[model samples]
Target: MSARSLASPQSAGEQKKKLADSLIKKFNKKFNGPLNNPHLSSIIVAEVGKLLQKAKISPGDLEQVEAKISREAVSESSAVLRNEDVRLRKIKAEMSSKGGLPAALLSKEDRKILPKELKKTIASPKKKPAARVSVNMLENTVRARNAQLDKQKAKHTSVFSSLGMVGPATPDSDAGNILVGAKSLPLDQAVDPWSVLIMHDVKKYEDERKQREEQKRLQREQWKRELDDQVKINERKKKEAAMEEVKYAEEEQDQLRVADIQEKKKKEAKMMINTKLKEERAKTVAELQEQKRRQLEEQKEEEKSEVRRMEAEIARAERRQQRKREEEAERAKRLQEENKEQRKMREEERKKKHRMDLEYAASQARMLDDLERRRLEALGKIKEKMKTIEVMGDTLGHSILEKEEEDERRAEMWRQAYEKKQLKVCFFRVCWCRGACNVCVEAVRDRGGEMEKVN
Candidate 1:
């Protein structure tokens, strides 16, 4: 071991010794600790915790030193025992050969039996039994618990049975045993499984059959009652409907006679209004045609005046061109050799200027070509834009048509609603007229009766 580990209080070896000593001490004190010490498990755990705390170690640290202390303890005990055995054997040999202090040594039987027993104890392996709960014991405990519950249930059931009330219960094997025990019959007969099963099946079938018959009888009676009720209702509804139809027909005929007379008067008025409107439309058309003829004559006279002005302008332009050529020829003859040297210099400048002009003309041609190319590209983009605009216009027109159709549909719906309202008004008017006619008829009948009595 390193000096540092040996010297340190919290080292592995020291921690193991502390843990083992603490365990041994707890065991020595009747397996009790500072607490009530009810069990060995708690004591061992407490000792382990206390030693680990003192050594500043963890359970993981204990793993390395777990077997060390136990192994050392065993070896220490075996060495002490071996030394004692050698001393004893030497003393026995001395007693045999020299007869020195024979009384101080053990007798032959004690010596042989002690060594043989010790050898046997040392040679035999120590068994570390695995701790487990016994399955048979657990099963017995469960069975006893079940029996207790069954007894309590039986007691409660017996009390309720006397009062003719029973709680719900599920059948199990134990229930049959209980029934057999309660019944006063021979054990063999009462415990017969087949007899129990047959009785259960018979009762089930009888109950089910009784329920089915009761249900079917109730359903047949309900159906017959419903059929009778429906027939009576149909007869009553038919009588009410026929009376209403007859009353409605009488009222409709009277209204139709009144509507016919009123319609004839309205048609005569509409025809007179339509003739007036047609006459007014024809007068406006004739006025518009006269104004158009006057405007066409004015436009023809203005065109003739413009043509005359254009012809005068063409004659003036031709005369100006003739004068310009005459002026150029006279100026050239007068200034021809007035500065011959200067003229030569002027000629050289003229040649350079002409070359420059030629170069400028070539550049202008290239620029014109570039402009033409740009114009072509622009024309293509304009065509594309036109196509897009056309499509957009078509879509806009379609949307407008759809909107107009929707507006028309809404207007038609409104017209239908107005017509329905008018029909309702007419129906109410007809009902009012019917009520007045009934009152008048009753009065007339009373007058006729009075006249007969007077006569």
Candidate 2:
């Protein structure tokens, strides 16, 4: 029996070797684990082995049970380990990628319980909120926005303030917090965010705004300049038109004045010509009247001269007729005286002849005377007586008687002769005187009658 029992201990050693091999295979198959740190794998395998030993089963049973529990534990541990390994690698990767802990890693408990060193390793640093604006910069922006809003609001204060409600406050107070409390307000009463932003960024926004405003102002100024220039041009044109009208009026007036002057000159010329013609006509009439007067005066003078010549001729004719009449009367007287002288001489001759004859006869008769003687006695006685007587008577008677007779006879003869001669002479003288005187008287009468007729 001693020999046999010693042989049985060898057989038990072989069975333990088999059980260990089966457990390793089950563990490997159940858990598909990754290759990890060798030290952790070794510690886990040793702990599994000690639990198996504590159960004190047979080597075969222990192998089976150990394999089952090891398989289960290894399967669950593989998932947990893989999860834990992946978490640790992510933590390390996060720490390496950002050079610090992820913000999500901090927990409420970790925040409360972490030591300073771990907190330093796990906590992420925070960036400060944007720095609060400077008081002066905020004041300046607010002032600028207020001033711009005021300018925009000038037309209607209520409407402009409503529209500009989002704008910054004035520089005097509360410039930065002006829009901070506006969110809880009603929609109508709220400040606009866009408007606030615009107000905050006023310097940049207003620069572009000011440029546009300047452009608009420049455009308005240019338009005003153009309008003013047009107005000036219109005024100038109106002035020129007015001046032209005045000039035309003045020219018309000048023309009228010239025409009037010309008409006046023409009238004056006509009047002068008419006056001259009238004066000439009057002068001609005066000359004609003066010529007629001179002609009349000359005719009168001629008539007067003719009358004086005729009167002188008539006086001379009268004187010549008177002288002829005186001469004819003297001739007639001389003829009568010559005829009377001749007659007286003839008468004396005849008487002397008769006496001579008587004386002769008486002488022859003386013888006869004796017879007468007887008678003579008587006679003688007578004779003696006679003688004596005769002587005485003779002486006385004879002388007386003879003387008486002779005287008578002689006286008669003388008377007869004288008477005859006187008668003849007287008759002749009368006849001549009658004829001549009649002719002369008739001529004188006719001449006187003619003179009376002429007168």
Candidate 3:
């Protein structure tokens, strides 16, 4: 068994087996097995080489070992050839001691050394020689038989004898001479052996028939005498039988008349019984027909009632469907109205919010304008008051009293402007340094814009 077959258990039976094995098997049958996969073979060879390295074996050593084996094989083959030559010489020497050279090649001097056994075998007659003698003897026996047959039936021989028991032989012919003769049949002609056997049997039958006919002719004459006596005895028996037949005919005639009368009575009784049975059968059929008619009428009534019930149910269902349709329409209309009202309210709320935003924006713009107006008006009034004080001081060149009055007037104006407009510029200018902080920068920018506006 192969490795695959040995590994399989008997009970497991047939299996396509491992996935890889099945794939490889199909691949090999389709491709050319391992030979077609050169890369795979190369990888396997490489792995094998690595494995052999563990045993300290290399490809070079493998080549040298193979070469040494080949050399030894050549030497052994040469020795074998030398031994074979010696063996052939010994065989020839034995043959020379036992017998001379074969007769085909023997010389006059070598012929005397021939073994006695071989000489006897060469001289004796074989199967072919003996068979030739037997054939000749058979031909002589056939000739003698043909002569006897001709003497018995010489006048009977004709052209048609070939198809008859004698087989076309004349008085001067030998047995089988027609079958073997060159002129008798075409060369290589096929003949059925059965035809020859049948002809021989027919000849034997003709002779047997002749003897049986002679014997039967004597028996026929003897049988005719016995038959004449038997006829007289049969005539006496016929006369007695004719008397008995007359008496039997009369008794049969009486019995036939009685049987005919009884048959007529039995026929009448059968006719009466058939009439009664027919009447019962007719009555039963009529009752069955009436019952079937009643069942059909009842079925028809039930069908009519069911049809009416179904029509009423359909009407009610239509009414319910119409009501449901109306209800759905009403609900849809109401929902449409609700959705419209909600949209209207949302639009009004959006308009109100827009108005509020516009109002707030206008109020902010008005407040900014008012603040700008107050600052400009206050700055202009302060400038006017300061110019009046400078002019009054120029007119009263040496008047201290007048200078004191101007200072009091300037303080009064500052107080009044601060109270009326909440102006803090004068106080800021008195306390602030130039660009000292956020307050000073914002005050300077505001004051510069106010002064420009006033100017």
Reference-based TM-score of each model: 0.17, 0.23, 0.18
Candidate 2 per-residue C-alpha lDDT over 273-332 given as tens digits, one digit per residue, 9 for 90 to 100: 578658866976896699679858966875686577777667666675686567557746
Segments in model 3 whose C-alpha atoms lie over 4 Å from true places:
1-312, 385-455
Top candidate, metric TM-score? 2
- Give lDDT per model, in order: 0.45, 0.43, 0.44
lDDT of 3 by residue, 409-434 (tens): 64465456556875444333332122
Pairs in steric clash, model 3: 161-168, 162-168
| Candidate 1 ranges beyond 4 A from true positions | 1-191, 258-455
Worst 10 residues of 3 by lDDT: 125-134
Which lDDT tens digits does candidate 1 get at residues 1-455?
22234346556676567646765564434212212224444445545655445535542234223223322322333343344445555544554465333121334332332322232322332332222223334455556745764676676543223212234433433433334324344323334333455566557656855875675466445433433453454455445435544543464455456546756865875687578658856976896698679758966875676577777667676675687578668756654654465567657856865886687557645744663464345335434533653564455444445544654564465346535653212111222122232332333353453211110
lDDT for position 425 in model 1: 21
Candidate 1, which ten residues in sequence have the lowest lDDT sum? 424-433
- Score candidate 3 by lDDT: 0.44
